[model samples]
Target: MVVVFYFAAFFVATEFALVQTRKSALESALEAGKGNRRKLQTALKMVQNLNEYLSTTQVGVTLAGIILGWIGEGTIEILIVDALRIAPISETGLHAIGAILGVMLLTYLEVVLTEIVPKNLSIDMPMKMMMLVVTPLHYFHILFYPFVWLLNVSAAAIIHLFGLRPASESNDVLTQAEILRLSRNAVTGGMLDKNDLLYMQRAFDFNDKIAKDIMVDRTSLEVVDITDSVKTVINYYLRQGFSRFPVVANNDKDKILGYVYIYDLIRQAQVDDRILVSKLLRTIITVPEVTPIQGLLQQMIQKQTPIVVVLDEYGGTSGIVTDKDIYEELFGVVKDEIDNVSSEYILKNADGSYKISGKTTLYDFERFFRTKNKNFDESESVTIAGYLLENYKVKRDDVITIGQFDLKVVDLNHNYIDWLEVRRHAASPDEQNAPQDKPAEINGQK
Candidate 1:
């Protein structure tokens, strides 16, 4: 009975430890060379053939349970009957009572000693438990190879009969959501940095974002006409300090010819000041505004173009997306030598209000405010400026009330709002129960 229960405990521990142990941990250990290489290799093999070894564990556990019940129950019942011989009970009644008590006591011991205890211990230290039991588990698996093989084939055949394919045990890949949750837990446990977690989360979000979500609007773009002289193109590049400028025909943005690199224009100007902008232009790629930035990034790499023109449904230029824009979406904003340290787009005032750039994304706004309003349709507009334009005719000092906040336009550049002052509305009884707004470390602001 004791030996059988010990084997049962071993099987239970091996089952949990193998399932819980990460394959990365095994590889890392093997690479580190801190322990017996042969044993670690065997452990890795067991993990690789997890389904086969799992069948071995199930078979071992079942056999151990059967043997324990066969030998243990009869022995325990005889002991109980002899111990309770002096009790005021008939011989038949005492035997019946002893049988019931023996089954109950055996079940209690088996559950605690062989099942729950070992399972919890293995889960708590999966790698350590796996290392401890791996050698014996490997030999047991080899001995039970025929049984494991038959069991696996039978299971597969039954599954096939039901028109379901056998799941590949090798493909234990974690989903993005699971990775995000694990990253958060790691942060909470002080095992990861918060900024690293944020980057990971943004990477997952990067694929879900479309080009228009991060593009510079056409109105804000600086371009040179295709008819412009080489000197004129150089002057435009010098004034704007941008790496590239789109070349438009007939002073029309919709009639984009291509883009000219600053270096290319400078080189041409040095050779001949009479060269037209169109002659030095590099071919630019155009993508629909709805194209996902993740796919667009691959397109940019394939075409060897760092910038692309975004077109709306009418086939006119709506905005432009650059490699820098996609980089910022994943890794946060990148600052250059010319960027002002004090000129953050989002700034908290002495009062409770916030001074935010009109170009601030609705995502950043919602993240900072710790609130999401269903009324703000992201499909209609991605930026605060665009959202305001969709519902109202904007003018300087115009106050627009959105959910939980009042946006007052502070600065306007042509038809677009450049800056806005955001003030939170007084929380209602229901609103008070929601997450309270706090200072956000976003948009290069602390």
Candidate 2:
């Protein structure tokens, strides 16, 4: 009985530990040469063929359970009857009592010793339990190969009958959502850096974003006219501090000829300042505004281009997307020597209000506010400025009330809000009804 119980416990521990241990961790350990090479190799094989080894564990557990019930239970019942034979009771009633006590005692021993204890220990320290049991488990698997094969075949057939596929090696792989959840848990447990977690989260979002989400709007672009002189092109580059500019025909952005690099212009200008900007232009790739950034990134790599022009449905230039824009989307803002050291997207004031840049992404805005306002639609816009434009006719010094917060446009450049002052207001009936400057007209309506 004692030996059979140990056998059952061993299989139970192996079952839980094999499933709980991460295959990546084992592979990493093997690569780093941390443990016994031979043992780690064997363990990896067991994990790779997890279904077969798990079947072997099931077979071992079933056999142990049968043997314990058939031999151990009968032996215990007989002992109980003999030990209580002298008790003052009829033989039939005494025998019945002994039988009941025997079953109860055996059940308690099996559950606590064979099932619960080892299961938890394996869960708590899966890798340690895996190392301890892997060798014996491998031997047991080989010895029960025939039984395990039969069980697996039968299980697969049953699964097929239900129109479901049997489990495979890929079952152990984690999905993107699962990996994100694990990263969050790791951050919570202090096992991962917050910035690393943020980057990982952004990586998942990277594919879902389109070129329109990160492109510099056409209105914000600085272009060189095809008719411009070499000196004029050089002056534009020096003043704007940009290394390259799109060459447009007749000062029309929609008629993009190509792009010109600063080096090309400077080299040409040294020879003759009369050189046309069009003569020094290099070919530029153009993509639709709706193109997925993931596929766009691949195109950029294949063509060896760092910038691409984005086109609208009308075949006119919508904007330009640069490698820097994509990099910032995935890794957050990167400051260079040209960027102001004191500039920030969002700043908290001493009076509890926040001064935020109009270009701040809606995701970061919501994260800082720690609330999701139903009034804002993420699908309609990506930035605070875009969201305001879509929902309200925003103008300089315009104050717009949204949910529990009030947003005042502090600065405006043309039609775009450049900066905003945000304040959270208490939810009071009097405050809601107080007379104030008229709120910005919604969607251009009076």
Candidate 3:
């Protein structure tokens, strides 16, 4: 009876040990960073074969367990009847009780000796675990190699008949959502900080970015009209503080020639300062203003042109772009020796209104209003200053409303409004009452 109980316990322990060993082998070999990478590579090749083989192995292990259980119980019954002088029916009762006790004992013993201990060791030192067990696994494979191959071939053919191919190695993995999840888990586990995790998520979301989000609208473009004399053009180039300028055939901006570099313009001007404005204008290289930011970048690279005049279908100049425009796409709004460190829309007075340069876009004002503006291409006006001047029937200290937004003409010039102020007329009352807990709350909060 004791022998039977001990044997039953041993069979259960072996059953769980086999399961743990196989699980440990599979996970250890498959893990990306841990375990023997070489073994993993080798294992990938055999995964299909072993996958089929392991299914059979599992069935065998289960059958072995059931048979061993029956044998253990019958032997224990015989031992109780013969050795302990118990009657056959009494032996059967004892055997039943012993079997239940044996199952409980086996459950605990197998957990400690097989599943729990082995799994802990495998996780802590996957490389060591793989090294110790890979040879055994390999030997097992060799013994069953022919059968595994046949099973894999059959499976692959069946899969192919269904128009499916076995999966192979790949570099691209971990979708944006998965990466975000992993980053969140990493932060929770102390493997990453909150800021770093957020940055990673933003990086994944960056490719969806559009041109309008980071464009320097026409308000910022520097242009030279072909009607201007060569002397005027040269003087404007010298004074404007940029390396290139879009040359238009007339005041009509849509009749753009390509950008003329300061170097090229200067070199040509040196040959003849009196060079005709027509001859001075370079051939135009223009792109639709609505082009994707990535498309613009690729076109710029392929065209090998530093400056691309932005144009509309109705033959209007939307804006002018230089390598600087494309570069700012990568490195957000660059500030160097000549840039203004203060607001691009600076308000000179104590009034909460902005004294924006005419070049400032209506988009900027809309952004200030905390409103979502649909991105679009426009040839009429590029900035808030241009939009205001064009819209105002009578340009004075005149203020007007478009939808919920308001524009006030503070100042104007012959060519462009030198400066102006913008504010939302409707939101003034709301703005006055909204909580001023900005830096005090979120940006300041831990």
Candidate 4:
């Protein structure tokens, strides 16, 4: 019975281990040079030809079942007959009772030790189980090579008769969508933290996002004229507390030449107080506004530049995208010493409402609201403020109702929206007491 259990467990573990062990893990192990590299390579080869190996496992499982029934049932029956000899009145009744008890005991042992225990172990520790069982399973396959080959050929012929293609196995590589689904399941099962899950999800999306979607608009950029005196440039850098500023030609921001670094300015000022801003300017790279974040990051890395000017379709400077911008998109905001910008995007008000920035992307706003606003069309604008301004032509201090939420423009910087206060409309007492046949929409979403 113990030997029968071992055969069953070997077959079960081999099936699951081959199916569940990710190809990526195998590749990583193979790349990491060590003594185990040869072992991992052998395992990868077995996994690649899993269709034949699975046929081998099927043969082992069937033989184990047959052996268990023949040896195990007979031994149990003999034991039961001896144990029940004193309680029996007739030979026929004694044999019948002994047979029934033997069958029951055999089934219990098979289900517990052979089926449940091995299957659970295989699932929980696929890699460990594979390492433990694969070597023994390999020897078993070699010993029964002829039988395994005959079984596989027979199975393929049967499949052909049914007009079905022969089964094959491939490397277990997951698509991005599949990975996201698994991550979501891991989060629900408490195997992964919510913050880590979010980062993983955003990492997948980072490549799809572009520089224009995240760059600081040109309206908010700080620029300096190339003709500015050294003292004036130093004062501008000190007052703004910024490490870098765009240097433009002839005091025209549209005619951007390059950028000036504060450290470079400080170093040059000590050697020559008469140094012009142009003499201190460093070469800045420019990228299209539509460049993918991944491509932008690669360019930055290859050029050793952290900042780039994003150009519009007409070859005009649209805005700026920095390493910080790309990093924020993937891993959330990362502030440096010179970064005095506020990290607060969503501010909760005293009246159970919220204040959000005008530049907040529509995707982020939907996450905060926890509902999609049907009134706002996603194609028209990328941000909530842009949507309101384009659709309703709202001004500062004006109140507009979007679905069930009242949006009041709380602040404005020139023509652009600065902040907005949003609140859900509450139901009247009569309406609250009345029975609702359907779900009440909150903030215009259900």
Candidate 5:
């Protein structure tokens, strides 16, 4: 029974270790050629031909089961019958009872010892287990090669006859979910930083997000008229701390012709004084709002265009997105010389909540919030202020309860909300009766 169990455990451990070990890591180990690195290199080569290697493990498991059932059950039953010989009146009845007890014990031991324990141990330290088992498993495979080859060919033939391809000889491809799980496990094992893990996960999800999700809305843009003087445009660009300005015609945003960089204006200013802003304008890429962020990023890279005007479904300029915006979406904020030390869009408070910009997307707001709030109305609006205003039907400066927090429109530009004050609910009766907290003074206003 012990020998049979050892064989079963060997197959179980080998199967998991081969599947779980990362090929890249094994390659690195082989390059280093230190410790068990050589063993891992051999192990990785075997698993690369996954179909044939897996067949060997399957054969080992089957043979172990057959041997255990043939000899193990009878051995245990005879022992039980001999031990109970003095107490039992009929030999036949005693033999029957012994057989039942023997079968139950074998099944229990097989599941616990051969299945659960080894598989879990292998998963926890796959590389280490792979190295340890590779040598013995190699010899076993070689001993059974002829038999295994015959079995594999027959299996592959049958599979092909059914109009299906056999499983690939090597399978290193991982699904998104599998990669995410591995990332999460790395985080748990302290092999990766939480923030880095988040960035990696978001990188994989970049395709799912669209330019509209992260682009700057039109109302928040500081565009310039193409008719404006270079001197005037220079001052405005410097004052606003904008790297580039959209050059529009006749003060109509919809008549945007191109864009001018602040650097270009400053450089050309030294060379010409009487130039119009239009003279310095460079062509900008235009993309639809629904374009995938990843596809847009590739287009920007291939064209060497840094800024793109995002158009709405009706073919009007909705907003603009820059390469910087895509970077922020994947890896968080990236500030430049023009960017302020503190973000104008995000303001932290003493009370543990925030005063967030109304133009900020629900995605950015949630990242700041650091907690999932599924109750927020995502259908009516994509921004925090828009969701609050539309869902609660509130006017400017109105306070509303949203999820587990209190939200107040702290600032407004016409009918559109500009800033909001958020705080956790005052749950106690005394706290509720206490003077309500006023919205924090923002942009030098009460």
Candidate 6:
């Protein structure tokens, strides 16, 4: 009975060790980087190696335990009577004592060999243990691969024969969303850090969104005339702080003939002295304005390059996005050399209210003031501008209230509300518990 329990404990400990090994090692490695932690890294690495062997080495331990338990009890009985000539064969107490000793020895061996040492290693130098024992354990796997494969196939067939579904392995397991969830969880649980989680979270957000979500509005795009001199284009590239330029004919952006890279344009400028746009321009890598950021990233990685040109439905250069744009989504806003750091929205009025673009989302306004919009309804639209259009029945420059969220339509275009001043009405009970919409950006989608 004691031996039976010992074997059971061996199986439980080995399986538990395998499950805890990988994440624990990863956590140790990450935390060790925070301090002068060479010792911690070394210790975790040791634990990792032990776990790799522990998982596979159990097969040997189980067999050895069984044999020793049988021999120590069964053979020792004959040995005491024949060799020692001390105990009679019919003595129950001697037989009981032999079995007890044998079982105790087996339990000690099982604990030392399978549980205590491996668990300590697993909880300590997990990384070192993994690195040390992975190869040997893998070799054992390969050695027994043929038999394991056969047994699996036979077991599966027997299950099917009984009119039951054999356990099926799917071709696809986790998705991009699921993996992001796991990464987020690891960070939250102290297994990973806040920065790493943010980076991964940004990557996922970037994947879900398309060029339109993060692209600089077409109004902000600066382009070059296709017929311009190399000297003329060079000045624009310098002013724009861009390595690439979309070349349009007569400032007609829709009639764009590819684009020109500064590198090529400059190289030709030296050779030709009077370089024309046609002779110096590089072809564009055009993608739809609405193409998902994920697809763009794949193209960027595959090309081993980071720039892409976004085009409109008519195939005109709407705006250009760089590999930097995608990366910024992951790492946060990357300021260009020519970026206007001082160009900020200011409340230019005594009313603590100011004129703002119609296109601005209310969410930004609310968060900017560190206050909630009591007059507007977030459930109606994701942005402040969207909320105004959806919940308002009268499209006039009038203050409207929805669920205590208020918005004063300060300006309106001929057809649409172009700009507005917005403020929340009062403390709203219902609005406080509303769910926020998903942010429109992602990264590292693949």
Q: Which one is best on lDDT?
A: 1
State the TM-score for model 1: 0.67
Model 6: per-residue lDDT, tens digit, 1-446? 45654544444444444445554545656665653364445434434554333434455456645766666556545554354336455566656666666566656766676567666765565455544444444566566556556656676689889998754223226787787788888788788888987887787787789987766556666678877888887776654456666677888756667667788878877887466787766665778989999988888788755556678888766666777777788888665434322114324456655555656556655544444544544275665566656666646668765554455676676757766665545655666575433321212110
Q: Could you tally the backbone clashes for each prediction?
A: 0, 0, 4, 0, 0, 45
Question: How large is the C-alpha RMSD of every model relative to the true structure?
Answer: 13.6, 13.1, 14.7, 15.3, 13.1, 15.6
Q: What is the lDDT, from 0 to 100, of the residue 25 in candidate 6?
A: 48
| Model 2 lDDT per residue over 108-166, tens place | 99899999999999999998899999999988988999988998999999999999999
lDDT of each: 0.84, 0.83, 0.56, 0.78, 0.80, 0.60
TM-score of each: 0.67, 0.69, 0.51, 0.62, 0.65, 0.42
Off by over 4 Å in 1: 171-173, 189-191, 208-210, 224-244, 258-285, 288-306, 337-346, 350-446
RMSD of model 5 against the true structure: 13.1
TM-score, cand. 5 vs. native: 0.65
lDDT of 1 by residue, 356-393 (tens): 99888776677567676665644589988998998799
Put down candidate 3 lDDT per residue, 1-446, tens digits, no spaces: 34533333333333333333434355654674666676655544433344543534443445445664566545544554455444455756766766666666655654565446655665555445545554445555576667767867787899999998854324225688887897798799897998787666555544665444444456555567766666666676544445556766655556666556667667777677676566655565666767776777788789787666666666566666566655544554555423432375656557666576777665545444445333213437777666655656646577766554555666766746777666655646655564321111111000
Single out the weakest 10-residue window by summed lDDT for candidate 5: 437-446
281-388: candidate 5 lDDT, tens digit per residue = 899889999999989999999988788889999988888888788888777776554443246788888878778788887755654544345554335588876776
Clashing pairs in 5: none
> How would you encode candidate 4's per-residue C-alpha lDDT over 1-446 as one tens digit per residue?
79888888778778888778766667777787643666677778778888877777888888998999999988999899888889835878878988999999999998888888888888898877877777877888898889989888988999999999886664346799998899899899998898998988898889788989888778877789988877788887664556778889876657889888888888888888677888887888999989999999999999988788889999988988777777788777565544422338778888898888888776566545544554454457988888877877777899987655688999977878989988978655654564322211111000
Error of 3 at 331 (Å): 4.1
Instruction: lDDT winner between 3 and 4, please give it.
Output: 4
